[model samples]
Target chain A: MSSGKIVELRQVLAERFPREIPPPASLLTTGIECLDRSLEGGMRRGTITQLVAPYPSCGSASLLHDLIDSMHTSASQFVALIDGKNSFEPLGNTDLLLWIRCENANQAVRATDLIIRDGNIILSILDLKQNEVQELRKVPLTAWYRLQRVAADSGTTLLLITSHYISGSCFAAVQINNPLRINDLAELSYTVSQTRLLDFIYRKNYAELGYAQA
Target chain B: MPKPSLFAVIYTPYYRLQCAQQKRLRTESNQQADLPFADRQTELSDQYSQSYSSNSNSITHQTIPPVTVYIREDIASALLEDSQIIEINPTAEAAGVKIGITPSLAVARAPELQLYAPEVELERQQQQALLQLCYRYSPFIESTGPGVCTLDLRGRRNKNQEIWARDLLSRWRSLGFAANVGIGPNAELAAQAAKFANPYLEVVENSQLLRSLPLESLQPSAYLLEILHNWGIRTLGALIQLPREDIGQRLGLEGLSLWDRAAGRSAKVLHHLQPPEIFKETIDLEQRLETLEPLLFILRRSLEHLVLRVESVYRLVAEIKLQLHLDSGDKLERSLPIPAPTQDITILFRVLSQYLETVQTAAPVVGFTLEVFASDPAKHQFDLFYSRLKDPNRFFQTLARLAALVGNNRAGIPERLASYKPDNIRLRLPAFDWKSNSSISAESDQPRIGPALRRYRPPIPATVELADGKPICIHSNLIKGHIDKQRGPWRTSGNWWDPDGWEIQEWDIQVTDRGIYRLTFSAGNWAISGVYD
Candidate 1:
């Protein structure tokens, strides 16, 4: 048969005898409605989910602290946060949180690689949002792809936080654009966390996102 | 019905000499791995054949004079003036080198004689290895001597004793020791059989082999043996032929014991020994090591052997202690604790290698000793709602790597200090023991206060345009914007009585279209402290 006809015949056979699909992996919830809803309930295991904060006072740090608090209190799981610019402030109960305060983007990426590959942590947050864009640009694209492969192999949830879209290796991306005002300082953190809105920006497979396996 | 107790004795003749040879052979084998394939096989074949023949009792004819070798305690070389030979290889025996003969006489008799000194540490290590291997056969084992041990086979019911005996022999041989195993009704007979066995032997009650054995096999004192020689008692059968009461009356208590041992009727009281849980390996480098690769290579090999030993004892390595002896008469020691006890070599090696990477040696290392503390594997029951670390050892190793990448005090479980100083936080290593006591409260009654602040490490310097004691516009390299609204000058200070005293006037302000930033005025200088996100 011709190649086109052979493809048609295989499609017909596939429709008649469909392959069994495995169940999707369990999701790790951050307990934030807006972010979780943007992630379709929560971040899926063995995938990279990027959170982009385009401007200062965009509530990325607030979101990160809320996520860490939610992991510690609600799920009782360990979270490793690789702080990109060493900018994270202490807040809430951090008994189950492993915070690695790195000086630059390179150190943060390396720390992220080490934590993700350890396979002991359930969720790893790479917070590079506060880093200078010039330094963040120096982080090779291959590092993200390598991290994606490691996360996939280790069956971990890797949340990459950045100032803008930097790599196509992530499985999904969401933009946190809530601008904070001086008045918001008087409000409760949980209320602010609940009021935050996330815009779902990107979702695709590794190959579709230009991360081809070698 | 209670079965008769059978004793098995494992003995190695010239144990100190053999330990030295084994150490040499091991060093040679390690060097051989780098040799060409053709040269490696030929060298190994020649050396191993010589080693096997030296341990063998069978004699072979030689047309030419063989290389005769002997062991002495104080010899620096074969030409040492007055050192006496304590142990001699079979070839040395054929060449007329007698025990207790001086090295000068030994060389005079055998022109190509070689002398070696005993390695006390290596001998001790091999003896411990032998005991550890024997413990696998029976829990009730005794350390009879430096190179001998006896296992009590009371409850074991395998009729085919040769299988396990051969198995034990092969296992001992794998560690470079040539050993013999003998099983008998009593410990005395078993020890006698072990000295005579080609590789293995078994003797029963009143067995002809036991009767024909010479009196020297009983290890009587020289004085007693001389008396027995005068009496013309040449063999155990002859000694046992005399009436026991008559010998006891004539020769006293020592005579009675000797006769009992001869007749295969000695007491079987074994001082049972519980093998020590010491897992250590040390190596003295042939040349001083000045680089990390070779040191790491040795460490990796040592860790493998230690892991094997720990696994054999049904335990895990809880901690590793490394001591590096330097050429400058100094020792650098480090102890790395395995958060979760494990038999995994990779994790253990990582712990060691990571430590070595940061070690700053003052001199080239001459040797290193690695010792592991063994522990029972930890067991824990996690709560249904709680998730525990999947691999604690690997996670700790990763934590170490993260610490290397970041600062040491910058990575771990973060806890806020009790003091009111802003950003007063410290990182502590996570607890290794995973006891699920519900120490962490699952739910908290405290409310989340507000959005978290991202603090600038050093507080970015800024020029503030102040009007009426309130900051208006902020002009910094990072952020330059006019202030639309301002909060207050919150004054906070502490530690005024000490050298590290601090005071600050902090204000929260909103710069138009830029962000909400915190400004601190301290010591007549204004800075952007952090951003409230």
Candidate 2:
């Protein structure tokens, strides 16, 4: 069949059976008030969500640790962290976190792909925040799309933590605009607790966009 | 009378020869697998070069025909000595080699004939495989002979007898043994039917089918056979025409039994025995396995067969035991326990492969045996609040692959070691059952301490200038900047009595505008320890 005919047939079917269309998927709430509120209840499942940390001392790493901690304590779900730079420090309880420490951006991305495809982990965080920008730039865009498709198929939540926005197929992107200060070191937990995350871009009809690209 | 007890016999023709050929094929495949990629490539290239060079000399390709082979009855004798050939393959028969012929005469008939001694161990293993497959059909089974198994289908529903028999025969074929099934009213009749069966046969009317047979079919005594021959009685129908009481009184008990057998009336009871539950397969390699590829290939094949056996018995493998015979006369034995009792091949392979990846043997392996312990499936009830792994086997397999990609110590659940030393942490293997936890409540609820430090492994050495016991300038591979703010000179020490004692002073400083970093002075050297993130 030609592409035009297929599209027409799909349109006719959709119009004929409007009520049969599925409702939007429920979000996966991490139980973090700030994050859940910013993401409008929680992160979307089966899609990539980019969390950009533009500055070095931003609370992205802290947020990751707390996010994992909260997920474990509240929901009792497992979280997988693909550490790009092998820099995460285990200060708190990490009984539910499966940390795969990699040396570079390429290794981290591959690890993320494996974890997502396994489907055992509900939320997978690919932390490329500390990796070199040049190395992150070398990651092909097609790799991101492949990851998105796998996540969609597996019904997994893939959160990409980066210094700059790299995934064009992400369902949404959130930025941590606040940078840590020396005084904030006195009460680090309090500072992280006060973390303010801003939503930058959210594709409400992300599935249509993904289909278009595909 | 109730229906006569049906009997099914699974027969493998030329069983010893089949076992030898199967083993030879396996060994050849293992040798191919053992060859490294470069060596295999070189071999291929050599073959190609030889073929290309030979093409110019001949318009037609010349090939060496395979030599006809037969198994000798008395394997203890030397090949040159005169020996009787017991089992002959089709190739040998096609070349005019006949059974019961002397080796010398057979060689003269088929000059390319190759005689092989029987392998008792290989035949035993093949027989066990046949019995294991037969056990799937009926419980009252007998090890009737070398290549035959008789199953008593007394209470079994005979509606789908042909279907299950075909399935059983196919399973036997998968183990590299071509077999046939015959169902009859008696064991002897079943065995006879199996020999002539086209893969499967069933005796419907025993008297009608048995009457046409010659007296030799019952293997009567030579004296009795000669008398019957003189009496002009060649077939069972003719012999049974005589009165049974008169024949018994005249010919004796042996004659009476022979007449009964010829009439398809078998009074012999079956000596039933349980099929051995032990699941193990061993191979003696022709070449010592110095690399892992061939060993893994052998193991994967063996494990697959063992799993099939376990499945046939309606059980799960609880543990896998691997024993390797090394050239140095030492055996390496290891048992790997499965987290979940499962028959998944991928998961079991991962468990074995992971162990092999880390093992360092003192000598090349000459042979190996793989065994699996079977168990009933486990039952577990989980808490309502927590979620468990959807597929534990697949999850563990993925974990093994991840461990291969990353270092073993790098991928797992991170546990903080109990010590004052900084960055003291170890990875714990993840559990199959995951529980929802709130163990972090104490730490999370505790007054906020500070941001988590992203520590650099093997803290980078740095050149520092200090004034008034405070760091003023810092230069390292990570950061080179003037200290905009400095906070700590916290002193700590541990293990003072031991030679591995250490003392350190740490300072949390802001690198001008770069970031807040942790600087440490230990053993009279300044280093950038970590960055606060």
Candidate 3:
């Protein structure tokens, strides 16, 4: 976030031409491209999911690209990429959403400011090495319940990409999505738009008719 | 004539688009003759990607072909900013003006005859030679960038580390590069330690230790230093006392980590290398060199010594340095980034002698030294059975050719050094891996902070194009670029409580070849976003 004013993609576009503001769709993905296809075409939003990897090679960034692309193409959504380690170097075509690169858990907390200021989807590129998650893990129940408790919290789907690194007790609540290889990101994007068996079956039965909401 | 470099060379481009085809951004690189694939050690390494799988190959096949007909304006050297960059691209870097002087002083150096001006070719020959040099030190070499490198010594410990250090020091000194060695548990601290030495070396455990060194040594944001000053924490040691929670809560993560770095709490590591390895050496000259004859003669022997030292070892040296002090004590160091990495003293003398005669003299030469550094080692981490493959010196030959093309930086290995500042944090890719490999970590298991824009020169550039006889951002002196349509001027205000606060108004406009350029005014300065194709 080079500028002091961090604006969302839609805001930047709509400020020039105001239009109806639609709710964002949260597309979660298993960091693995193959695994993401097995899911409902993409990772479902509004739910917490955990990713596990012993090594850095796991498709963490690739999955992030998927999740971000999902939030972007499915609907014009803004995203927050909290890079706790100061690692995520913005690629060329990533401005479709509002991406925030923060350094630690502290800046992550300020995430509230970004959401309130520019409404959009949010994800964490956290450096799990920070001890905060370990502390957060002790009482994930209280923390998450409180997070859920915040009555007026906006509808941004917060996707955290911490593997063995993410330590909050809340992690025990969700199913894990593990991706391998840094290159896997491209692999996951290709499958996001493709029709999957789950999509066909769900659409025939329980799947939402339109897009999933944040 | 200088004996030709006995090294292999290879060059390649990053992602390139083809005008002829509609899809697929393919890699544009060239390969060289086979070099040895041996290493002193191997990690939890995998060669799963050396040879492309049919899947990727087929993927590339679906891509477009390069078309000279539609080169990008930047690639075609049509843009004004790019025109300035064109001159910086030396055919070959004069052994990379080994010593970095003030920008003004660098400009002052005479445009002497080029010993080797290898044009910047599509292929990378310098990388091959650099890898050879790094291989001599360790299997795990991480490139800091062209002309600079780091070797992680923690994992690859040897019997005589100091002796090894001194030998390499003399080697680099002989080549003309100011070699500085920083030893520490993490890569950042070691890197910071290496900065003090202009041909200097030191070791520090943490930022607290390093902060005591000098403020300029640690490249953090200016705001960070200001915050430290207000807090009465002047030195790195003084700053370390402020609680972690206090820093994290106040300074933001990069700021907090910078404070931590000052306290010497770093854990970042080197990344796995691409192909070649990097090598280095600084002068361990006898307190002084006597006459010009003995001085040049001894420098040649040291150069030859370095050449033979790595003969059986697994690496090559494509660069050479001549850091000498005149009787007047005004030092002049000269280097050339040629493709040929050699040990032949006579050849070294002939190549260097031609350029030496051309340098303006202030006094008699007192100290003369030379050093050789690299691109990447020819040996990459493979699942091969051999533990260490020795270099056949072919990589040095390739470096000679490549160094002759792109300036010196292009001739060595590249490594990205992490920085709090966007520009400072840009990758400082060097040529030594073994020195850098020790710092690499297994998992990047970091917490998701958020999406950060890695804009080296922020307020990403946008050419406000012609529209209705106007360009975007055309009017305001602060807001540069062409003026297009002036959208709404939306403003956001927050963080009023903090000294470092913001009140910004933004406008979206369609810039030149660039897409929607985001023009912003925060803190009374205009910045444009949306750099384009």
Candidate 4:
């Protein structure tokens, strides 16, 4: 076939069987330029974003601190932290933070559901980095989907802090691999804010693209 | 220009009879006299004797006793007192009983009569109730007489005054009183209209309606009434027809004053009053409330009535005091605080039902008194862009439900306790004025650092193997694995003077398969304190 005819045919095919273009994700700025730039523009609103840090004492804790600090300083919004394993040690003024200290993954999940349904807090961080894998495994996949639905409905930004990937329904998963280097607390905070985390977006057309001819 | 003044008079025809009947019903069930009937009789009889002896007029003069007996139902009856019949019910009147006649003579005339002694206290209470009910319509109210109240409706705009009058009378009827409401320009005219009006009447032109009423409806002295009767001036119109000068020349100032009133020209100043602020209603249930549904039904009805009263005054209900009288002679009392003062009946009913659901009564409820404390309506202006609670009342109600589901002390905003003890916290209800801006502090002094801890309610017991004074392995119901890495055994102790003093060593350990865990070595026992999720 001629190139012009092929182009027209392609255009007709595209219109008849349209590609599913997801709506543009609304972003809620983390107030850190580096993080926002790395994730296109901060975190996606109304979706779960997982921050996985496999090793102990990785800069994930510091990253969480910076996210909370940025939200507090920039938007003056309240952040709810549903601590799964009771390991997070809050430092400094936590006036804008609601700390729901849960004993295990189940309690943390329940707390997260309650806060998400309440729809009062702007950002909810479900930190399960210190919870045992066995305990986290008990949290049904349905629970994660429910959380995702609730977060979307409420337009709340849910940041899941875990040691491994748990939520299949997450919009994107970012891994914090940089270890704790700076000893000074102030320098460590600044360094954590600049560190580039790996971002993995879960696409809907992956299976379709795999079946298509290259 | 002065506002056109309108007055409404609510008159209960058989106030004493209704009060006595109510008292009898109330006592019949309890088998106890809240106020002794015999003592009331003696008091009434003594007052009658004094008034009778003091008035040394002709025998034709009629003296009204403070207490009057009337036949309410058809039953065997006898004269409880030799005193004259001051008041008689329709049944007694039909049986040939007349005022000023002795009770014995009336009983002889008709053998079947059911006489009920007057409950003076109950009548006074009912009169006060009438005043309170009328006060809801107009602020200027006066207790004109027993079960009679005059309300000034001046400056009050109503498209249909007759409908308002009928509604007032209907409310009174629901309270067990056959009341009539009348509207006029003055208190005297309104009262006269009320006495003659069939259930409800309004006097647009006072002279027109006032002319047909009997002179006795004005409640003039017996001597004046007798003089008017002698002159054949039976109706107010006939009395008003006579020349004012002639009446003054013939019967002096009293006659002129009476003529003025008959002419609807009496400038009677009403005793304007401030209604009582107490919004309480006590209801004696006919049947004991054995279930929550019935109790809630009664409570909702009472709350609706009270809310109507509150709304008339442009106020909202802030709190409710519920006192349930149990059949066992014990009382259960609860005061429910409204998180947001509201005038919505549905919201108030929800609040009341939520409270009643949690109530565990020792005995069935025999009676209840519900008093709603009203407050001035609140005014607020929210920011244009700021987020607010979708429904504050619903949120509070949901909080209550959640509390009931979990526990009283479990749900709410968590507040940290001021102590050295680890995991010291308490839950407190959110403030009524919960502004989003108030949640975050304006001052950014403390540098935010580290992740927040997720505390286990009670630390799980765990076995720990130490290598060189450091935890190397950990096993518990939640986590079982070797410690991959470990942090310090931070020692802390406090409250040494008290018996609850504590000393502990806390360690942050990262298990191999499990996540990071906080281990505490206290009193020779090791336990997993929390997870850093």
True contacts kept of 1: 0.80
Say which candidate scores most in lDDT.
1
Give the alpha carbon lDDT tens digit for every residue of B308-382 in model 1. Answer: 556546567899999998999799998899898776666677788888888889999988888999887676766
What is the number of backbone collisions in each predicted candidate, taken in the order shown?
Answer: 2, 2, 163, 11
Candidate 1 residue pairs in clash (backbone atoms < 3 Å): A189-B449, A189-B450
Best by TM-score: 1
**1 or 2: which has the higher TM-score?**
1
Q: Please, what's the RMSD in Å of model 2?
A: 11.3
Q: Candidate 1 — which residues are off by over 4 angstroms?
A: A1-23, A205-214, B1-5, B28-82, B89-98, B101-115, B129-141, B152-175, B221-233, B245-254, B268-276, B281-286, B293-305, B433-444
What DockQ does every candidate get? 0.48, 0.43, 0.02, 0.11
lDDT for residue A43 in candidate 3, whole number 0-100 = 40
Model 4, span A1-214: residue lDDT tens: 9967865665666566664443455778887665666566767777788888876546576677677777766676668787776555554446556666566788778778877777766688998887888888999999999998899788888999888887777877777665442132224346445654555544223122111222
| Error in Å for residue B106 of model 1 | 6.0
lDDT of 3: 0.40
lDDT by residue for model 2 over B1-533, one digit each (tens)?
79667899998877776766655556554344323344433543454345435545322232211111122322222122237888776667777778888888788887777666666776787678677778878899999888799999998976668877876775565455667898888898887778778889887545566778788877788999998899899998888888889889989998788777777787678899887888887878778988998788777767876776776566788899999999999999999888778766677888899889878899999988889998887777877978788888778778878888886787898877767888878888887675435566455566548887887877999999899989999888888989999998999889999998889999999987788889999999999888888
Query: On residues B262-297, what C-alpha lDDT tens digit does candidate 3 reach at each position?
Result: 766765556647453323333333334443444444
Per-model TM-score versus the true fold:
0.83, 0.75, 0.26, 0.69
Residue pairs with colliding backbones in model 2 are A188-B449, A188-B450
Q: Write the per-residue lDDT of candidate 3 for residues A26-89, one digit (tens) a residue.
A: 4544344443554444444433334443322333444455555544444433344544443444
